[model samples]
Target chain A: MSTIVKVGMADLKVVEYPDALTTLGLGSCVGICLYDSTTRVTGMAHIMLPSSKAIRKNENVAKFADTAITELIQIMESKGAKKTRFIAKIAGGAQMFAFSSQNDSMKIGERNAEAVRAILKELNIPIKADDTGGNFGRTIEFYSESGKLLIKTAGKGIKEI
Target chain B: MGIEFDRMNNDIIIDVLREIGNIGAGNAATSLAKMIDKKIDMKVPVVKLVDFDEVPEMLGGPENIVCGIFFKLEGDITGSIMFVLDQKSAINLVDLLMPRDNAEFDEFTISALKEIGNILSGSYIASLSGLTNLQIKISVPALAIDMAGAILSVPAIHFGQMSDNVLIIQNEFIEVLEAKSVDGYFFLIPDLDSYEVLLGSLGVTL
Candidate 1:
């Protein structure tokens, strides 16, 4: 049986081939899916913030893009996945609501996506599929066997990447 | 730091929180009752320290579809407030407010619902300001129709930047319209820094 593991907000999980990883209802939070097709090892992190350095409490490693990506890669490596074979697919990071005068905090979704993009570039991990921004929430599922990510929305319908 | 966590251990402190919720929610319920011209019954607010993981489950798990109205509380206090209604209650409310056959959430329906949220949240915040003697201002209401977890992540991420624990005041309003039942929820979350200013104004300083 291919078990599907759930990754909560500010949380993460790693699974082997034939297994899947999912995260529900992402708003202004980014879901990072890292997969090594050769080993069929996959990892997902539900990151809420762009950087942990800006915040005081730094206990939750999976809560920030900077920390979560690094941590996720390490965990995937431990599961017999090589860093060079890593392919990234990201979803969520949506502006769930619109406001007239945009505040620094209100643009978190855009910020999170940007941060993830930059960090992945620095790490030399090429993103296979990218779906970020807009005013909506997303529930994403990542299949480890095929390294495919599925994105579902309330009204926008579903798409695979 | 927010209100002295040490005090939360006291039963008397919990009662004070309850009183605060009653005053604000009571006013909100009355205004809603008048708007719909229906009898509305409100239960005592449930106040607790909720973790980020438990937030989505507050309204029938994270994936449960809900109509959530978000407001950024500004001025003397800074935090976030959300008024949530399940799919059934959302449809019932739209029908009650606009009174039409086969009401769809067209532009007009959404606008009406946004205004309703604005008015209700304004009243709730105003009541708190009156009780605490604080200058609380609310931002324009933002409405989202999606899964509860997604809707709630906005506030959770906002407050999550500071602490994992968020203080929540969950208020339920029941509308008595015969056998069919309808309900709505108000979730009040004060920013950690605002707690000192909020609690101090009510003369409950430690």
Candidate 2:
């Protein structure tokens, strides 16, 4: 039986091959999945903010893109996954509500996606695929065995990357 | 550092705010009753400082589909208010209001529902401002039909950036019309900085 680990909002989890990690109802939040096919180790983070430096709250490391990606990578490596073998697939950075004035805070979805990409680049991880930027919410499931990220939405149906 | 400083620990302040929320919720129920043309009863407003992750469970689970109308509170107190209804209740409401033969949430139905949310939230805020003597203004209301977790995440992200715990005033509205039941929720999230202003105006000081 493949164990399914559920991640909450602003939370993260890791699983091995034949197992999966999933996070549900990602609106402006980004679900970054890092996997190493060799070791079949997978790590997923549901990041709500782009950077922790911009805010006074620094307690939750998994809640920010800057900290989440680095922490996920470290955890995957500790699980016998090689750093160089890591690749990324992300989903669910959506502008859930459209506002007339383009405030920086209101653009959290775009910012989160950008921040994840920037950090992944800095860490030398290639982003294989992403299904993002629409005005709908998504629930993502990441399978370590196949290195596939499955995204499910309401009207948009589902996709695998 | 926001209101999470030592002030939030004061029981007196929390009780005062809870009372304020009760009054506001009462006003909202009245307005909603008028709009729906049915007697709307609201449960006692719950005032609590909840974690960001746990908030989605307030309505349902994170993945539960819901219809939300969002309005940003501006001026003296800045925050957001959302009137959320589950999918079935939302369609039921539209059916009650428009009585279309087919159950479809078209653009017109959505716009109508948004207006209903606008009225309820507006009255809720108006009552709060009136009782507290603060000048509270509201932005245009926006509607989103999505998962409960997704719709609430907008304000959660904005508020969670400052503090892990968000102050929420949640009220449940229910009405049984013709033996059919309908229910929804009203979520009031006051900005971190606004708590101090609100308490100060209410004669409570940290």
Candidate number achieving the greatest DockQ relative to the actual structure: 2
Off by over 4 Å in 1: B1-17, B96-108, B177-180, B204-206
Candidate 2: residue A124 Cα off by (Å)? 1.6
Candidate 2 chain A TM is: 0.97
CAPRI classification of candidate 1? medium
Candidate 1: residue pairs that collide: none
* Cα displacement (Å) at residue B176, model 1: 3.3
lDDT of 2 by residue, A15-107 (tens): 898999999899999999999999999999999999989676578898899988888888888889997999999998899878887676567
lDDT of 2 by residue, B133-189 (tens): 999987888889898888878877876766666567777667756534446666676
TM-score of each: 0.90, 0.91
Chain A TM-score values for every predicted structure, listed in order: 0.98, 0.97
- Model 2, stretches more than 4 Å misplaced? B5-13, B95-104, B176-181
- The lDDT per prediction is 0.83, 0.82
